[model samples]
Target: MFRYFLNRLGQGVIVLLVLFTITFFLVHALPAGPFQTEKAIPEHIKERMEAYYGLDKPLGVQYVKRLGTLGTADLGASLRLEGRDVSEIISQAFPVSLQLGLVAMGLAICIGIPLGVVAAWKKNTILDYSAMALAMIGICIPAFVIGPVLADRFGQQWQALPAMGWSPLSPSYWLLPAFTLGLVSAAYLSRLTRAGMLETLNQDFVRTARAKGVPEGQILVRHCLRGGLIPAVAYIGPAFAGIISGSLVIESVFAIPGLGTHFVKAIEFGDEPVLTGIGLLFGILIILANIGTDILGAWLNPRLRSSR
Candidate 1:
């Protein structure tokens, strides 16, 4: 297990390195600098600004300097937000995103798993069809669309919740945004879980369990659920990363202040450092999530444990 973990960690490091390199170059390759816009600036002021940010240095030198900072766990100051460091910005913004993501993930697991299990257990029935139909609607509709409609229905018409903005002290602030982010993922998970459960149910071990007169509930929970959940477990890593990063449209619609909002502004303003910092953070989250998924997968599947 130790060796397996180390191997996965090493792979994750390599993936992050590749992602960082690509993002660094791509951001640099953009046509204009962070200061350049429709208005013209004096040449000397531009030169000084470039020198101040070390943008006057060659791209190779800048890359190496940034790499060194990364090695030392220093994200440096934000070019766009004067006097603010990237890490500090991330620290302030990420918690809101993290809270939202966790809530969404919980919603997905709680609702999706039961719906899927019931659908699979009662296949070819009205319950199965109704659950699948709802899942399909979730899959088809984007969060941007769902968010406003929910806001209007619940927030405007019914006055059940606020239409926009988030409040850390209040749980009510979490519901609308969390639900919008989770709905699509819940649909995907339900389908994936149903498929996995159906496949597990058909396996020879399941038949043997039934033949041996194991209680159906025990067989389903003890024998089948672990295997049936493998796919959903695997999917959680990347999906969770995506959720925690904050959806651009959802954030915009809800007026939530998260890393994603900064990310979008950074792009528009050509704030390469902010963009790169956020991108690196995203890569790290994804890599860590996948590593966790691998560990969980091994624990759930004896074949994986032995193979590793």
Candidate 2:
């Protein structure tokens, strides 16, 4: 297991390096300065600014410098936001994104798994049809549309929750945004769960368990659920990375000060450091999540552990 973990970690490092290299060049290739302003600065001032940020250096030199900074775990300062480091911005924003993501993921797992299990168990029934139809609707509707409609209905028309903004101190502030993200994720999870459950239920082991007169619920829970959850576990890794990065539209609609908001602003303003920092962070999160998924998958499937 230690050797396996080391191998995965090495692979993750290689992936991050590749991701950083591509993003660095692509961001620099864009046709503008990171410090572009509505009012033009004097040429000398601009030159000084460029030199201050080491943008005056050759591209290769800048690239090497960026790698050096990354080696020391320094994200450097945000070009657009005076005196603010990329690390500081990320530190401030990530907690909100994490909270929102955790709530959403929890809701998705809690609701989607049960719905999918029931639908699979009662295949060809009204309950199955209704659950699937709901999942379809959830999948078809985009988060941007759902978020505004939810805000309007619950925040404006009904006055059940605030229309926008997040308050960490208040649990009420969490519900709308969490639901907006969770419902969409749940749709995908439910379908995957149902498919996995159906396949597992038809397996030889499941047949043997039934033949041996195992209680139906115990067979479903103990014998089938672990295998049935494999697909969902696979999906959850990347899905979770996406959620923790924050939903762009959901954050905008809810006026949440999360990583997604910073990411968008960084792009719009051509803040290269911030953009690359967030991209690097995202890559790290995705790689870590995948590693976790692999570990969990091995635990759930004894065959995987033996093969490893």
Candidate 3:
């Protein structure tokens, strides 16, 4: 296990390096620097700002310096955020993103697993058809579309939920956004769970348990459901990373002051330092999520454990 963890950590480091290199070149290649905007600054002030942020250095030199900072756990500073340290900005923002993502994941698991289980147990019935249909809608309509519709119907017309804006740790603020995100994700997970559960139910162990006079409910829960969860768990990692990264679009739509919104604004304004910081943070998130998925997979599957 230690060896496996070390190997994954090493690979994550390599992935981070590649991301940094790509982000550096991409930011530098933009037509305008961070100082350039619709309203131009005085030439002297722009020059001094460039020099202070190392934007005046050759791209290669700036790349090396920025890369070196990562070794010492330094994320530099955000030019767009008025001299706030890059790490500080990320630290402040990560928790909000994390909270949103976690809430969505929890909701997805709660709703998706049960929907799937019920659908599988009642295959070919109304319940199964309804669950599958709902899942299809989820897959077809993304959260971006659902968010506005939900706000309009639930918030605007009904005036039950808040229309927009984040209120930080307030359930009222997070409830709509989190549900919008989770519901869309859960739709796909529900289908996957239903399929996996159906397959597991057909397996010989399930049959043997039934033959041995195991209670139907006990067989379904102890044997079929547990086995089925393996596949759903496999998807959780990538789904989680996607939610975190994709939150940018949702946050923009909802006017939430999360990392997603901050990152989006930075990109739009060509804020190199802020954009790079956000990119690096997102890249690390993806890598770590993938690593965590691998570890969890090995733990859940004895075959994987033995092979490793």
Candidate 4:
């Protein structure tokens, strides 16, 4: 297990290195510098600015220099937000994003799993059909659309919750945005869980459990559910990675201040520092989440444990 973890960590480091290299050149390759929009800055001043940001250095030299900073946790200042370090900005914003993502994932799991379980247990009955129909609708409707509709119906018309803006640890702020971010995930999770459950129920072990006179509830919970849950657990890492990165449209529509909003703005303004900071942060999150899931799965399943 320790070796497996170390291997995953090493892979994560390599992936981050690749991302850093690509991002460095890609940003530089853009037709303009951070100060390019300022047509008024004279040639000498522009040259000085480029030199100050190490833009004057060769691509390989800049890459090497930046790699040194990365090694020491120095992500540098935002080109757009002068005097502000990229890490500082991320620190302030990440908690809000993390909170939103957690709320969304919580909602997804709470609703999706039970719905899926009921659907599978009920088979082709009304409960199954209704649950599947709901899942289909959730999959069809985009987060952006859902955000406004929820805001309008639940916030504007009903005044049930705050329609926009993040409030630190505020329950009111959690309702709309969390639901919007979670709805699609819930749909997918439900479908996956139902499929996995159905497949596991038909397996020989489940049949053997029944033949051995195991209680139906115990068989379902201890055996069928455990096997069925694996697929949902597998999907959870990426689903969470998506939520943590923020659904750009949902963040925008709902006016949630998060990494997603920051990323889009950074892209629009061509703010390389902020963009790269967020991109690297999100990439790290994805890699970590997957590794964590793998480790957890390995621990849970004897097959994986033995194979490893």
lDDT of 3 by residue, 1-308 (tens): 77877988898889878888888788778787677888979999999988988889887898888888878888777778886887788788878888888888888889888998999999999999999999888889889999998888888899888878877757887878888888877987898889889999999988888898999888888788767877788888888888888788878777877888778777776777677778878887888887788778887677877776
All candidates: TM-score: 0.94, 0.94, 0.94, 0.92
Model 4, global lDDT:
0.85
Worst 10 residues of 1 by lDDT: 243-252
In model 2, pairs of residues that clash are none
Residues 1-308 of candidate 4 have per-residue lDDT tens digits of 67877988999999998998888778877776678775578999989888888878887898888889988988888887878899999998888788889899999999998899889989999999999999999999888788889999988899889887878868888889998999999999999999999999999988998999999888878888888888888888988999887566677877888777777777766787787888899899899889878877775566987665
Model 2, span 108-176: residue lDDT tens = 888888888888888889999999999999999978888999999999999999989999989789999
lDDT of 1 by residue, 1-308 (tens): 78978988898789878888898899888888788878998999989988998999999999999989988989888888889999999899888888888898889888888888888988999999999999999999988899999999998999999888989888898899999999988888898889999999999999999999999899889988999999988988888888776466687788889887888888887887788888888888998998888889888887997887
What's the lDDT for all of these models? 0.87, 0.88, 0.83, 0.85
Q: lDDT score of model 1?
A: 0.87
Q: Which model is ahead, 3 or 4, in terms of lDDT?
A: 4
Q: Which ten residues in a row have the lowest lDDT in candidate 3?
A: 299-308
Candidate 1 local lDDT, residue 106: 89
